[model samples]
Target chain A: MFGVTILGNNSAIPAYDRHPTAQVVTLNEQLFLLDCGEATQMQLSRYKVRRSRINYILISHLHGDHYFGLIGLITSMGLLGREHPLHIYAPAPLQGILQAQLDVAAIVLPFPLHFHALQQEGVLVAEDKFSIECFAVYHRIECWGFIIRENRKPRKINKEQALAYNIPGYFYERLKNGDDYEPRNGETVKNEWVTIPNTPGRSYAYCADTIFNPEVAAKIKGVTMAYHEATYLDNLIERAANRFHSTSKQAATIARLAGIKQLLIGHFSSKYEALEPFLTEAQSIFPNTQLALEGVSYRIL
Target chain B: MFGVTILGNNSAIPAYDRHPTAQVVTLNEQLFLLDCGEATQMQLSRYKVRRSRINYILISHLHGDHYFGLIGLITSMGLLGREHPLHIYAPAPLQGILQAQLDVAAIVLPFPLHFHALQQEGVLVAEDKFSIECFAVYHRIECWGFIIRENRKPRKINKEQALAYNIPGYFYERLKNGDDYEPRNGETVKNEWVTIPNTPGRSYAYCADTIFNPEVAAKIKGVTMAYHEATYLDNLIERAANRFHSTSKQAATIARLAGIKQLLIGHFSSKYEALEPFLTEAQSIFPNTQLALEGVSYRIL
Candidate 1:
């Protein structure tokens, strides 16, 4: 049920039938927007991604290719009569920018918009079932990478065993929490005997616009999958470094070092007309590497 | 040689395979961008419009649908190493918004970007071959409409007559300027004998994002073609008025009043799946009415 859908996969200049950097991270019924580039809202609708279900938006940096479509999405939400509060996590300056635009247009949102500035990278979101942690990355401007991990699920109760023990149905919630069943006879039934652990939770890491930095590999280690920017091929390593971007080989190497189960590479430069070379280059280094194609959803198993 | 290519035609919410308002006005070799909505750069590329030739961009209002794609287009120009200067005519607030984004991204353009704020309605560009003027429009915000007019062409020279008159090849320029040739013998070669007037110049008016306002009809009179925003159908006249938008019938009425030869109606509401009703409604009043389909060029005859 947890997956990442790619809305756009191109780099600074959107060309060759590809768009800029934007994606949707789906965790069950809730959707989290990742780096909304231009036309992201349209792409969401095109892919049948429910815009109303998206309550969280995470922006990696101030690059136009990364977040130019944010204001439009926000405005569209208001026009569509979204009543639920939306949360945006981005650089501090983004709040002022959004506020200025809204003020000039004299637009009052129908819902509340909460802005959470990413001044210092840490645990930005922590819930009972999942958590999101952000860490700094090497880029020309302020940027960060995020790791979303689903917490271990609670134990499942054995319904037949509970009924046989004469446990009341109203106490199922407590039983799922590893509580023993106690009847009026003053006899206590063991919790482990009537319950079993649920399946293990999965994790996904998003490495946004960044150069080749191997130091953060440990932070993303053992994740179900990792998405890293491969803006150029290995032949243009100098160009990639100058632009504060990453090469396919460099991204794949980091994914291999981090022991990720699947490696997704995208944010391709407009100079490249063919994306097959990027997949080839990355797979040469990490055999599990896959090209991040637009509109395709990569499940985190 | 003068035409407008539609990039997007939907209203506030881009859906149902349509996009927001965006168009490219082509005057021979030059292209002027009009109301750059989301993913305008992609549309320009899709239509094979020369991005390098687009030296001017006109933004009608502060609405996100009108200009949300501007920053991305400008940034892409810089990333593509555009050395020619780009001029943008928009509301005063847009310059600051673009500057803030560029500053935060730490991106310095390779070319000069000139911002001309549209505080009043006046002529923005006056060249020998063409001229562009902006006029106020009745919208929710401080919006403006653009009128692009190709200048009166020069006279076509009769090469045989000029050669027989012993008129120097260098004097051909003067001949086109409606000047008669004179030899040392004091015999004047009448201008009428050597040249004929070229075809009359054509004009196209863009009435961007506005409600029905009859006062400005005189300003656009005698235009070859006009593009008006038909945001809603006749049935939603109340809704259109509440949102400061216009219906197809209203747009047609204005086009007819302005004496326009051809009328293009667009900026359709996303609520409707079919656009045929818009054409039918508009054409009922103005027979020359046409639907502004994306990638279709409406030539000013």
Candidate 2:
């Protein structure tokens, strides 16, 4: 299953009720953390997210609201006796910060830490059954948005057709790979006659901490789900632009232009007590829009 | 008026029900933070401690459990448009770490930040109605303990003697300063006959994150209240020694040696779910010992 869980959704200042920016993206059994804000570990525990399964962390920027919880989480992992290697992908400067904190505390993790610096734009940071591509976003600091796509599955074979043709069990693998074989009697068959092509894989794009830029529409085209930051309302359009952040309408416009199936918007200003207006404004432009509420889970499909 | 409010009392690993180390030292209207752990700003809000009134912050060490919340707190203060200057007393390396985070986010506080580095032992960090002194402690890192003493008040004059001698208001100041009063008529009055000595002031010592070291007893002698770390039980004596931490018995012994009126011990290991044993073990050595419960206020006098 491919999905994303909102750990925290508020902007710069974390309030008593709303928290800062943090999200957990689940790809099958492995979990990938996106932008760990302060109290993210608590949020993980509060929401019952198993932190032991997290193998990768992706930091969008160096803002405190984006990554302040990193040191605490790393320390907790060590204390909990995590032995598996953890991978971190972020801007180059984050390594120095993390190293300094660990060094001061005299903490030596049992697990190996592999840091992949996102110095240049349009690079593939990680890939496996799922591929994550990083692209530049317009922000006050160096920030990048991630596009995650699940690998396509093998073609499915028609059991009735294969059985009627008397295909051997050993030839099933070849048939799924679009190859058809003849039996000992030299009977031949076309691969398309028994197997159907696999369905298109789903894709999700996370546009982290960015201003409303039409250029982003080209990068996230045809995605199944897209999470764009909408930190303010239309009334605070000038303030949003000054802070290099997007509004609800602008985020929805990008999702509409990108042809994404669903749009989830969050990172609201602390001044906003109610988030219904954000959903209303975005849904006016894109009917498939939803609010990124904390502890809420959205399936990628 | 002189007391401490426990903001967080848990050990290194923060649990959902408990938090990491943090305390608010309230001296009249001013508030001083002691060991701000991760999410301390939220803890401050949860306990209704006014973060805006905090004028000073004392960092015991560079452990993430002690100072990780500082950057987020400072960032939130700036975002809230705090105009008052904040003073931070910590080791030298913290300055670079704090500056790097601030530089990355391009956040400039509206108030001035005065960073006082603890280089040598027995340095007086602050002096006002209460004098703060710092002394080195036995820890894995360069840690320091703080001693806060309320300044002694002037000696009170004997009202009956003063009225009979017709002492003027101008001359009362000299009498309080231990000087004999000489009237304009050339009559000399002995200072002891006119004024009585003031009462001795109270003091609180915070021996934060330290091992059971005898040297600390001399520095915290005659303190009214002492807050020491008891990270393990007697059974884990070897582990406590290896980690440069103290057990409940060791902390109680130090409190007894220091002759403190009351002892508050905390920083329980995460391995143990209950804290009753800590209090029991400590009270065996020091009868005035108490456990540091979160959100609880303890009087220094």
Best by lDDT: 1
How do all models score by TM-score? 0.90, 0.94
Chain B structural similarity as TM-score, candidate 2 = 0.94
User: What RMSD, rounded to one decimal, does every model reach?
Assistant: 3.6, 2.5
RMSD of 2: 2.5
Best by DockQ: 2
For candidate 2, give the lDDT of residue B256.
95
Best by TM-score: 2
lDDT per residue for candidate 1 within B1-301, as digits (tens), equals 8899999999989988788999999999889999999889889999998899998999999988999899899988888889999999999999999898888888899999999999777799999989999999999989999999999889999888888888898999999989998888878999999898998789999999888989668778888999999999999999999988999999999998998899999999889999999999999999999999999998889
Q: List the residue pairs that clash in candidate 1.
A: none
Worst 10 residues of 1 chain A by lDDT: A215-224
lDDT scores for all predictions?
0.91, 0.89
Which segments of model 1 are wrong by more than 4 Å?
A156-172, A178-197, B155-198
